[model samples]
Target: MTYETILLAKENGVATITLNRPPMNPLNSQLFKELGHAVDEIAEDNSIKVLIITGSGSKAFAAGADVSEMAYLSPVEVYNFNMGSRKTFDKIENLGKPVIAAIAGITFGGGCELALACDFRFAAENVKIAFPETGLGIIPGGGGTVRLPRLIGVGRAKELIYGGEMIDAVTAEKLGIVTKVVAVDVLMEEAQNYAAKLAVRPSVAMKMAKESIQAGVNLDSSSALNYENQCFITAFASEDAKEGLGAFLEKRKPNYTGK
Candidate 1:
């Protein structure tokens, strides 16, 4: 499928979706719709084991939502727009396969929220991340309020969101928001290498593990354990599991078919 706001590429079990708008890839309704379509395509492709999301230029992964678009919107229209964005981000978070955010430059508001949806975030040394919505007299309407607090504790989340302060990549890593920080030149390379490594793992087991972890986040200890056990059973029943066990006994590498 064709997209105007994003570019999609697939190879070697890894798919990349690049936000094409340069300088500052502002999330507008058109971009959101295109992103949703790209995500859906990646989710349905069995050969694509992992996804990496990034922006076109080094200037920004994304700056924020298109304020120009939102400025003229009525309360009802803005609410609907935000709801659509929330749904798209939710899809990214629950994409079944691992998703990595290769972030650089400015990441604010909806941009920061989009990165939060990914399973891993690898930021460049030049990256600056924040949720500066409060400064705009608005709050994060793209799952930022919900996911950020859950990720880095309420205190730190509040510090970033409420203060509307931008933190460097290292600071974000120290706060547990960024998985790793790399040189700006090697950011995409590092992310792609990591994605390649994950793509080679047993797909069924990986998917189940991802699902278990995500589900456990909202579940109680006892219920989470039960759900994890169920996920384990499901993974254990896959053909890859049998091959993995046989390979272990035979002292050979396992060949996974993603079954």
Candidate 2:
């Protein structure tokens, strides 16, 4: 589908959704709608094993939500808008395929929340990330408050959210927010290469593992273990599992059908 605020491309089992607004791809209602559509497209395509999300220009993955549009919104309108954004982010988080955020330059507020939804975040050396909503007389309404604490410690999450200060790529990595940091020129390349690697793995196993991890996050140890065991059984029953095991015994490469 053609999208005004984003570009979607699929290649070699890896799909990329680029936020097309240049300079700083600020998230707006239109962009959020387009993103939701793009995500739906990716989710339905069985051939697409992984997805990478990034911004068009090198200066920013996304600056934040479009404040100009948001400024005039009424409280009720804002609540609805925030809920829509949260739904989109939640969809990305729950997408069966692994999703990677290729972050560069300014990533703040809603942008930071978006990255938090992805399974992995690959930031460029020039990346600066923060949740600066507090300065705007609000808090993160896009699952940031919930997910950020789960990612980083609660104290650190509170510090970042309350202070609304940006952190450099190095600091973000040290804080475990960024999976890896690379040169600006190679940021997309790194993300693509990693996505390609994941694309070739057993899709069923990957999906099961992702689901297990996500679901286990909210469960207690015993319940989580039980859920994980169920996921393992589901993966073990797939055709790919048979291929993988047979290939291992036969000393040959496994050709997964993503079943």
Candidate 3:
């Protein structure tokens, strides 16, 4: 598909989606529409085992949602826009395959929320992340309010959201917001390598594990454990599991076909 706001490239079972509105890659309605289409394309491709999302240039992962697009909208229009973005981010977060956010430069507001939707994140050492929505007389309408607290605890999420303060990569790493932080030049390389590693794993098992973990997080302990056990058995029944077991006993690496 032709994409104006983003670029999609696939190689070796890994698909990378680059936000392409140069400079800061501000999120606008068109960008969100293209992103939804991209995700749908990825979802239909069986060979795509993992996905990576990042923005163009080293200046920013994304500065924030396009403020100009929001400067003068009716309340209904704002609600519609928020819902569209929320749905896109939710699709990313709950995708059967793993998703990684390769972040660099400034990541604020909706940008930060977008990264939070990914299963993992790798950021450049100079990355700055924050939710500055409150200062704009708004709030994170893109699932940030729910996901941030779940990721970094309620107190910390509240503090950051309420103050609209930005934190550097090191602090973000320390707070568990990013999977890892690397030098600016190696940010993409690191994230791609990680995605490649995940892509080679037993696909069915990996997807099951991801789903189990995500669902478990929101359920009661007893219910979560029961659900996890069911997911485990489902994975155990896959052909990949047989291959994994056979290869283990043969003292050789498993060649999973994603069966």
Candidate 4:
């Protein structure tokens, strides 16, 4: 499918969606629309096992939401826009396959929320992450207020959101917001390598594990444990699981066809 605000590319079981709106790649209504379409395509394409999200230019993964598009919007328009953003983020979070955010330069406001929706994030050493909406007299209308705290804890999330300060890559890593920090030039390469690694795992097991984790997060310990055990049993029934066991017994590498 054609995309105006993003670029989609697939190679070797990995798909990448690059935020293409130049220097800052600010999020807008059109960008959100294109993202929804792109994500839906990715979900339907079995050839794509992993998705890496990043920005085109060196300046930003995404600076923030396009304030110009939102500044004068009616209250109802604003509500609809926020819901669209939320839906896009939820799609990424629940994509079944792993979604990795390859963050560079500035990732603020909605951009930070976008990364949080991913299973994990990798950032360049120069990347700056922030949740600066409170300073603008508005709270994070997207999933930032929800996902950020669940990721980095309430205190840290509050510190970032309330202070509205841009934290560097090292600081973000320290806060557990990003998975790892890499040299700028190797950021994309590293992220792709990680995706390639994930793509080779048993697909059914991976999906089940992801589902269990996402669901388990909101459940009580007893219920979560029970659900995890059910997921384990379900994965054990897959052909890949049998192959894995057989290969282990035979002392050979398993050939997983994502069954």
Least well predicted 10-residue stretch by lDDT in candidate 4: 140-149
lDDT of 1 at 51: 98
How large is the C-alpha RMSD of every model relative to the true structure?
0.7, 0.8, 0.8, 0.9
Backbone clash total for model 2 is: 0
- Model 2, span 141-249: residue lDDT tens: 8888999999999999999999998899999999999999999999999999999999999999999999999999999999999999999999999999999999999
lDDT measured at residue 71 in model 1 versus the true structure, 0 to 100: 83
Off by over 4 Å in 1: none
Instruction: Indicate whether candidate 1 or candidate 4 has the larger lDDT.
Output: 1
Q: Show model 3 residue runs off by greater than 4 Å.
A: none
lDDT of 3 at 61: 96
Q: In model 4, how large is the Cα lDDT of residue 75?
A: 99
lDDT of 3 by residue, 1-259 (tens): 6899999999999999999998999999888888988998998899999999999999999999999998898999988888889889988988899999999999999999999999998999889998999998999989889999999999999999999989999999989999899999999899999998999999999999999999999999999999999999999999999999999999999999988
Give the per-residue Cα lDDT of candidate 2 at 13: 100
Error of 4 at 87 (Å): 0.3
lDDT of 1 at 241: 99
Q: Tell me each candidate's TM-score.
A: 0.99, 0.99, 0.98, 0.98
Ranking by lDDT: 1, 2, 3, 4
lDDT of 3: 0.93
TM-score of candidate 3 versus the correct structure, residues matched by position: 0.98
Candidate number with the higher TM-score (1 or 4): 1
